[model samples]
Target: MLSLQLIRDKKEFVAERLSIKNFDAANLLNEITALDKTRRATQSELDELLSKANQLTKSIGQLYKAGARDKAEAAKSRSAELKEQTKVLSAKLSETVELLNKKLVELPNIPHESVPAGHSDADNETVYEEGEMPTLPEDALPHWELATKYQIIDFDLGSKVTGAGFPFYRGQGARLQRALINFFLDEAIDAGYLEYQPPLLINEDSGFGTGQLPDKEGQMYFANEDNLYLIPTAEVPITNIYRNVILKETDFPIKNVAYSNCFRREAGSYGKDVRGLNRLHQFDKVEIVQIEHPDNSYATLETMKEYVANLLRKLELPFRILRLCGGDLSFTSALTFDFETYSGAQKRWLEVSSVSNFESYQANRMKLRFKDKNGKMQLAHTLNGSALALPRIVASLLENNQTPEGIKIPKALQRYTGFDLIK
Candidate 1:
């Protein structure tokens, strides 16, 4: 949620920044300013009435003490009138505040100045690229086909049991999934992030804390009986741990890593590109979350990008990093970098992870604050990224490392998988 003061004092600045995110801010900002003015006026009027009532009450007390009962009774009657007026003023004040708050939440975080201005993924700049796209034989098939040929993934049985998009990972496929999870978690732990196993379902506030609820309500599976939503990412549960917390300056930069089976309704996303491991209703991901002092947040973003880059390098998969254009960026992120892997058979780049720094954008909503040196509480910056998501990585691994014999394991993961080949 945006601060009202920002809309009041820095309206132009906010408007310019949001333009980077392709948002038009003129009208909504105007409404916020108008509502804020009415709120202030209402509050001032209430304060004046209360002040007069206090003065009258003090006179009434003095008159009663001097035995002037009649004067005191008259003052008391006036105080009652003041109280009645105050009730209506208070109601108006509450309504104005609600209006201001609604407009504030509707505004997304302004994109950082450094973010590129564009409309779609095609406008995203390739900030970095590593490894070479693999060479595969013409007869090579994609992972879905390879899975069926090898009896690794069974989609038909999954469809018969629970409808589409809930396929079963069998034999080597299941083992490989486990190996990937452990490898990602171990790598993250070694990198200094404390591991957490978060609950798979969360309440409405938890969903909003991570910017998943209000905007993407249809994208989540809601349990109407319990009023809980199945978590779309570990980021929701892991980050909400600091909700309503006031942190010490020294305790800042909270680094957390967690593995979760993310559930999404995948609403409105259909058609050809959603094939194979490209999209799924449920998938596993390793997430790294950080709450940092605003000063160090951007630096932390760089570190996160490097960490993800290194992970892809270790896997020996060809990859490129795209600086997301405004329209392609997530709603709550000021700036984002997407890591895409080359999918050989699909002839496209599969987005494997997104690293972003939400500079105080999420903190304000979560009420996640930190005390400065002077003992003043302020919102801290929050950052997170998929250290890695499983299915697509597995897809890239199978496609890039495919050989006449079998799929060869990357050296770093060979130890974790307990074998060098998936054959």
Candidate 2:
């Protein structure tokens, strides 16, 4: 959410920036302006009423002290009338404030100046590419086939026990999954991120804090009995740790990382796109989050991008980074960079991670603030990226590393997996 002050003071400027995001803010802007006016008017009236009531009380006390019994009785009557008026005005003020908040949350974050004005992933800008595309044997199999060949992953077993998209790892496949999780966490820790293991089930407030509620409510798995939603990413719980917190200038850069089994409904998913490890209901991921001063945030975003790139390099995967256009950007992100790895057998680039800088959108929603050098409170910029998402990375590794003999594991992960190849 953007600050209400920004909307009111620079209505036209804000509306123009939102246009870059393909958001027609004309009606919503008008709606917000009107609601804010009503809220202010109601509050003014309530304040005046309270002031009058207090004066009446003082008059009643004076009358009683002077022994003017008749005057005191009349003053008491006026005081009662003012008290009733106050209650009515207070209710109106509350109603107006609530309506104002509803309108505010409907507005998406303002796009950064660098955000390209366009629609869809096709309009995204490719900012970086690295590594060579591997030349695989003609007999090389896609990840699902390779999984079957090596007896690593069991999709059929998962379907029988829990339905599709919930895969069961067998023997070496299970070990490989564990190894990937540990490796990702180790890498994040080495980059100075504090590790956290957050709750898989989060309450409504936590969801709203991360902008996952309202807009994306249907995308998450809801636990109806407890009214909690299963986390779609570790980013939710980990970022919400600083909700409603205020920090000093010394805490300029707050970094955290978490490993979790994420769940999503992925409703309406079908066909080859969702096949095998391409998409899944349950998947493993290591997430990195940061809270930083506004002046340092963009620099920190670049650092995070490089860190994720390093991971791909170590894994020896051919990868590229795309700067997402407004349409493809997440609702809460001001700027986003998506990392895609080339899946050799699939002959397509699969998205493996998205790193984003939210500016102050999420911080405004969660009240995550810090005191500046001037000792004034300001909203901190928030950012989170997948250090690595397991499924697609696993798919790329299996597809690209396949040989007639076996699938060769990257040397960096050999110690973790306890084997150089899955035969």
* Top candidate by lDDT: 2
lDDT of 2 by residue, 328-398 (tens): 88888999999999999989999999999999999999999999989999999999999899999999999
Judged by whole-model lDDT over C-alpha atoms, candidate 2 comes out at: 0.94
Per residue, candidate 1 scores C-alpha lDDT tens digits across 1-423 of 777767788999999888888899989999989998899999999999989989998999999999999988998999999999989999999999988877888899988888999999989999989899888888888988888877878878888998677789998888888888998899889999999999999999998887886878899999999999999899999999999999999997689999999988898888888887889888899999999999999999999999999899898889999999998998899999999999887778999999999999899999999999999988999999998998899888888778888888899988887888878
**Span of ten consecutive residues with least summed lDDT in model 1:** 1-10
**Model 2, residue 239: C-alpha shift (Å):** 0.8
Candidate 2: where is the Cα deviation over 4 Å?
57-73
TM-score to true structure, per model? 0.94, 0.96
lDDT of 1: 0.90
* Clashing residue pairs, backbone N/CA/C < 3 A, model 1: none
